[model samples]
Target: MNSIQMDSDPIAVLMQEHHRAAKQLSLLEQAVISINVDGFTRHAFECIAEAIRFFEGEFRQHDKKEEQFLFPLLEKHQPGITREYRNEHRELWSAFNHLLSCVNDVEDGRLRGSSRQELVETATRIVHLLRAHIANENTILFVKAKKLFSTEEYKEFRDNVASVTA
Candidate 1:
């Protein structure tokens, strides 16, 4: 069975979410690495469809939290580093959209053979980019931003995110 680690720290919890998303993305990569999207049916189709839905829906909302809540908090506190941080987030956002498009292509019967290869490559690139983004955000950005927010500020963010996502 699959189990997740429990962490009460708000930032830690969000980082864990990132880890879970990355794991799901990795599973999709492995799924595609060994099969053709159009060729796979039955169980494989279900699995890939679930993965795509999670990435397309859940992860997209998660990105909203970063863009609306987290990044703004960090940018307010650390103007000097905002450029690099925003740049990375922007690129990752674009890559995620591209990955979504590739999955859409597969779902719509446009992906076959080498087209499947392109889809897999696009997904893999998103996974790599997000993994890197999560690492940096957890190690540096989140930690620093936590310092900037008062307990009140942090609590506001925490409550709003939980309410929307729940």
Candidate 2:
């Protein structure tokens, strides 16, 4: 929903969001590396904060668009596919919250020693998980959507996306 236009193709809108998420994940990975080498710094904290903001804000809305509008249609054609994506969504949400908690702890000076290591590990895990999840959606789910939806169906999907995102 960030910069996606209402008139744009819904699949393209989702793909744009995926690209944004990929960038944020990469930033998180870099922040973890920075923390490991130089310990906590403002830059590292900023990276974590940015990622948290994206997860809580734009990313959450994007997921809603998929879950409420996109996924159900896809589910009809591919019964179990939505289940897999939803499970991944839950896992990613949990992981993001955990990482955000760790970031908050670090920001407050409550995190130290092994806790910092744990934070780094958690961030790494999230980055990897999200990248893989995005890949799956881009390659499998989006491809299927393109093939399955009629023009009218795609327009309806777009309208639903606009209604939710607007």
Candidate 3:
């Protein structure tokens, strides 16, 4: 932990956003399992698309900044802990991207020729990965970042979150 006392580290705030994203992701995943997308159910597709877009729009920015700026700072402060966080972030992002790509294929009709099982698998994998990732960040990384960073740091992070939510 850096001796610096930031009001709230941006990482902690971003971690909170991840928790919210995880719940929404779960709803979309449930819809995927329960609904028939290959039947071209427009409403179901729209719901899933909206959720995916929400993640792409909100989560992407948070991750980018965390990976690019906040993460590096934390790594400098605590190499071992930051390494674990960074790895988890990368894995979660990869799974999310992979899952979203499958959804995009279905939306574009490319996945129409495939088994519905593929789509189901994609949804399951994404939901599982995101939930686990959020749990780890919320329980471990967020607390660490909050304790390690100072108030000014927290303010900056909050501003970033506000900009995205707005």
Candidate 4:
């Protein structure tokens, strides 16, 4: 079973999501590296496709949970604390869109030869951006949330996240 499913604590569950994101990003990294070395193999294509699916679905949901539930509460506790994180979310979404377009171009046979670099660059951007964002959330935002949130607030967050993720 996934740690996200096992953990009742909302912060812990979010951390689990971060772990999953890290794994996916690692796959993307490996795929790009393989493309660079061996050219576009089926394995690389499958990895990139899997990454696209993940970012389109679970990644968006995770961000939505933070934006909707977590951010508001954090902002209430400390005004403007979440501003940078919100901005990063916007940036990540933009990169995700770019990556999607690049992947689509490859899938549709729109780009050849150059598609490798395009895919590598775009995936690198998203992977780096998201990894930094997750690091900040795990190290800073989530730490503050744990310290500042009341038990009731924590419960509400857990319940809200569970409802959405379920």
Candidate 5:
């Protein structure tokens, strides 16, 4: 679902990936909450693992495209705003690493009640942060990029995205 078709606009493709990431994060948040209420089970671990894998694979690629192509283009026009968004990306990455660590611990049979609680808390934070991040990028970043880039620049950016993502 994260795979974008060749004909689609690159910005639209990134937005679609964001939506998919949000859905996966919501699933992770719910799974963690369920584990907190009902205690950790194999199913919960599987869900968490799957979410982590999705992030590590597709989501990471999406992040790279933004960082490598989109952000730099935006930064040329809006350095302050781009810097703020890049900081947010760093924070999001830290949160993701925390969630990945928690999942690894669970897989290793270290699912204490406190650990489950931590997982739920971490996942909730990630879900909220990412939702906000996506909204900001969609509304502000992408909109500005669309308006600011010349036709040739936008085409080059889109082609770079396609090359990396393909």
Candidate 6:
């Protein structure tokens, strides 16, 4: 492969997704903070909705790519190192769902008292968890994959990632 192709391989694609997700998480955090303070202005609502949509769609697809295309090879090479990341994916999903629920409650005008608190807390949890999770994968898992995979293996990885559905 040429240098440009090498730079834009599967791992690089995943890293780009990570960067996008981190921005969405930041938007989510700011939206939640705005709602907590100002009771959901139009910009805050839009930001929250946009972030939720990204997570429900692209973020889920990103996770599927890792789980299906990347994790198996890592598991084959290192045995059990992928397990913690798998579990974290599940935890992140749970927290995201909780945040979604909280948003729904707010939309329904049910975000009073404890529900407001729950929304803030859930948003905080998902933001922190996802940020840390992304950082870990970038620094550790993807770095390992880059070092371990041969050129042929990377091509197969890229092909599989392209062919697989979320």
What does candidate 4's lDDT look like per residue over 49-109, in tens digits?
Answer: 8987887889889999999999998888899999999999998888888888888887788
- Model 1, 1-166: lDDT tens digits are 0122223545765786788787777777667665664455555555566677886777777777776777776666766665676687778678767766766776787866676667667667777777787788878878777778777667766765676567
lDDT for each candidate structure: 0.69, 0.87, 0.68, 0.87, 0.84, 0.85
Model 6, span 1-166: residue lDDT tens: 2233653478878888999999998998998889788976889878989999999999899999999989998887789989999999999999889888888888888867788778778888989998999999999999898877767777888888777532
lDDT score, candidate 3 = 0.68
Better of 1 and 2 by TM-score: 2
**Per-residue lDDT of 101 in model 2:** 85
Off by over 4 Å in 1: 1-8, 36-44, 111-113
Q: Which stretches of candidate 4 lie over 4 Å from their true place?
A: 1-7
Global Cα lDDT for candidate 4: 0.87
RMSD of 2: 4.1
Candidates 2 and 5 compared: the better one by lDDT is: 2
**Residue 76 lDDT, candidate 6, scale 0-100:** 73
* lDDT for residue 66 in candidate 1, whole number 0-100: 70
For candidate 2, give the lDDT of residue 14.
Answer: 92
- Show model 2 residue runs off by greater than 4 Å: 1-7
Regions of candidate 3 where Cα sits further than 4 Å from its true position? 1-12, 36-40, 111-114, 150-166
Candidate 5 lDDT over 3-115, as tens digits, reads 33347588988999998998898788778777878887777777888788898999989999999998888878767768878898899899999988887787788867688
Candidate 1 similarity to native, TM-score: 0.75
lDDT of 1 at 101: 76
* C-alpha TM-score for every candidate: 0.75, 0.91, 0.73, 0.91, 0.90, 0.90
